[model samples]
Target: MALIRSILFNLLFFPGTAIHCFGVLAVSPMGSGPVQAIVHSWSRMHYWLLRHVMGISFEWEGKLPAGPYLIAVKHESMVEAIDTLRFADTPVVVLKRELADIPVFGRVTRRYGVIPVDRDAGATALRQMMSLAKQAVVDRRPVIIFPEGTRVPRGARPQLRPGFAGLYRMLGLPVVPIAVDSGRVWPRGFVKRSGTIHFRVGEIIPPGLKREEVEARVHAAINALNLPTT
Candidate 1:
C-alpha cells in the first residue's frame, strides 16, 4: 500500500512541479515575488497531496519568526525544506552549491536568491555565502539554513557545521531555531509513510554570543525535537 501511494505521489508531483517551474520561468523577470509565489504554490500543493493522498499531515507548534531573521532548522527530510517557503514570504535558503546548477531547475534557485555553499572551498565559500545572505537580510527576507549541513535520520544528533555560527555573527541577526520530526514519516528519497510531522519552533537566540555559546544553544534547541517522549 505504501509503495503504491508513493508511486502515485510521484506521478502527481512532477507534472505539477513542471507547470509551476514553467510559470516561474515565464515571470521571473518581473521579480522575486512572482517567482516566490510559484514556489509557495508548489509547496502547498505538495503538502496537500501528502495529506489527502498519502494520509500524511503536519502538526506545527509555535509561530514563524518575523522576516530578516535567520531560521535555523533541523534538517531531517525534504519536507522541512519545502515547508520553509510556507513560513516566510520569500525565504533565502542555504543549499549546497550543486543544487543551483541542475539544468532547468537551477534557474529557480538562482532567481529565488538561494545561498549556495561550496563546502570544499572552506572559508572562501563562507565569505561568498555571507555576502549573498547579507543581501537577503537587507531585503527583509527570512534566511533558512540547516545547521547540520545535511539531513540526518530521526534521533541522530550532530553538531552544527561551522558556517552556521559564521552567518549568525556576520549577519548580526537574531536566529530562530526550528526543530522538525519530518524524517520519521518522510525519510529521504521516494518513500513517505503516513504520519504526522511536527515542527517545534524554539525561542529566538539573539546575536553577539560567542561561537561556542551560539552553537550549543542552536544544537540543543534543535535536538530537543528528537528526544523520546512518553
Candidate 2:
C-alpha cells in the first residue's frame, strides 16, 4: 500500500502543481474576488487529489469559528496547511517569506492572498503581518497562522513562536486553536503514507486576554487533542 501510494503521489504531485500554476497565470492581474475563486477551486481540487492519490482521510472534530477570527494551528506537516484550504472558506495564510521565492508555487500562493513574512526581519515582519491581517479581517476573510512557526515530527512538541501574541493583541480578534495528527500520516519529507489524519478544533479564545494567557490556552488545546485520551 505504501509503495502504491508513493507511486501515485509521484505521478500526480507535479501535474497538480502544474495545473495550479496555470490557473495562477490565467488569474493574474485579475481582481481579488476572481483570483480567490480560482485559488479556492485549485485548493479544493488539490486536497481531493491528495486524498485520492495518497489514500489519506481527514477527521475534523469540533467546529470552525465564523468570520474575523484568528486561527492559530499547530504545524506538524505541510499537509495541514494544504488541508486547511479545504475547510476555510477563503483564508489568508501567514506563511514564511521563503515560500514566495518558489517558482510556480510562489506565484500561486501570492495570487491567493497568502501573506509572506520575512523570518529574518523581526519587528518588520510583525508589523507587516499585523497590517495584512487587519486588512484581511476587514475584508471578511479569516486569518490562519501556525503558532509553532515550523513543522515538527509526529508526536514531537515544538515551542510556539512569540509573534502570535503580538498579532493576537494587535488584531484583538478571537483566536481559534486547531490541532492535528497530519504528521503521523504525512510525516514530513516522506513520499507517501496511507492513513487517516485527525484534526481537533478547540474552543475560541476571546480577545483582550493577556499574551501568555492566550498562548497557554492554545497550547493546552493542542496538548489535549494530542493526548491519548482523544
Q: Judging by TM-score against the true structure, name the best candidate.
A: 1
lDDT value, candidate 2, whole model: 0.79
Taking the candidates one at a time, how many backbone clashes does each contain? 0, 0
Error of 1 at 127 (Å): 2.4
Instruction: Please provide, for model 1 over 90-134, each residue's C-alpha lDDT reduced to its tens digit, 9 standing for 90 to 100.
Output: 899999988888876778888877999888887777778889998
Kindly provide the TM-score of model 1 when superposed on the true structure, using C-alpha atoms: 0.95
Clashing pairs in 2: none
Which candidate number would show the highest lDDT if scored against the true structure?
1
The regions of model 2 sitting more than 4 angstroms off are 227-230
After superposition, the stretches of candidate 1 with alpha carbons farther than 4 Å from their true spots are 228-230
What tens-digit string does per-residue lDDT give for candidate 2 at 1-230?
78777777767766876886787778687767777776777677768767888888888899897787889888877787876786886899988889976987888788787778787787777678788888988888888998878787666666678877877888888988998877667765557678888888898899999778898998878755563312
